[model samples]
Target: MIKYHVRKDQAITEVKVSGHANYAKHGEDIVCAAVSTATILTYNALERMGFKDNLNVSVSDGFFHLEVLKPNEFLGYLLDNLEDTLHQLELQYPKYIKYQKEG
Candidate 1:
């Protein structure tokens, strides 16, 4: 599994991607789906923290993008949300991947 943490301003989002990088089309497709789901989870968390609606989310060409209406005000909140999310994900999917961040 390859994992990374993306921080925009102060908002930190952890992305852990696992699966066969070199495999059949179907396997790659599944990995894409997993990545997309993780992205949605991040986006929704930001929304819950009062991020304004700016652009509709779209996952295509193996990329995910989200427009944050206010980066300054929402940064800390977003990172906090990400931390909580990672914790939950660890609990829910213990066998998938673990979030390794030093607090």
Candidate 2:
């Protein structure tokens, strides 16, 4: 199963994603692929928008952690998109994924 946590506070949003869905073999798991695609898209967008100075990130096999140190309205909106995507996935595949959001 894959588990992720999102934290939102004033001027900050931290997201951590870890583990594989294991819905199928590692290379052929659609659940994992879907999550990866969504996460990568968010990460890329943050980078392209020049949030590098206000962010901390770590990416590796089956893990991604993004910390938004100085979130603004735009960044918050973008991160909300990410949360929505993950929430949809969690709802669709309750057996394979879990999501938690906190403040």
Candidate 3:
């Protein structure tokens, strides 16, 4: 299963995603592919929005972590959108994805 954890601070937001959705074989797992695509797209969007200087991103097999070092309105919006998308995925693949929010 994939576990997504979101954290919010006064002016920073951190997202941590880990684990693989063992719903199917490696390349055949739609859940894993969806999660990976969404995460990479969000990271690219952040860079395109010029927030790369204030962001920290890490990725490895079955793991991804993103930290917004300085939060702004646009960053908040992006994070919110990411959270919503992850939540929607969780709703559909409850056994394969899990999401949690923290402050």
After the best TM-score superposition of candidate 3, give how far the Cα of residue 67 lies from its true spot, in angstroms: 0.9
Q: After aligning candidate 3 to the native by TM-score, how far in Å is the CA of 35 from where it should be? A: 0.6
Whole-model lDDT values for every prediction: 0.48, 0.87, 0.88
* Candidate 2: Cα lDDT at 88: 94
> Candidate 2: what lDDT?
0.87
TM-score of model 2 relative to the true fold? 0.91
Give per-residue CA lDDT, model 3, range 23-97, as digits (tens): 999899999999999888989999998999989999999999998887788888888888888889999999999
Error of 2 at 1 (Å): 0.6
- What are the RMSDs of all candidates, in order? 6.4, 2.0, 2.0
Superposed model 3: Cα runs more than 4 Å off: 10-12, 100-103
Which lDDT tens digits does candidate 2 get at residues 1-103?
Answer: 8899988676338889999999999789999999999999988898899877888999999999999877778888888888889889999999999985544
What TM-score would every model get versus the actual structure? 0.39, 0.91, 0.91
TM-score preference between candidates 1 and 2, better one: 2
Candidate order, lDDT descending:
3, 2, 1
Q: Say which prediction, candidate 2 or candidate 3, comes out ahead on lDDT.
A: 3
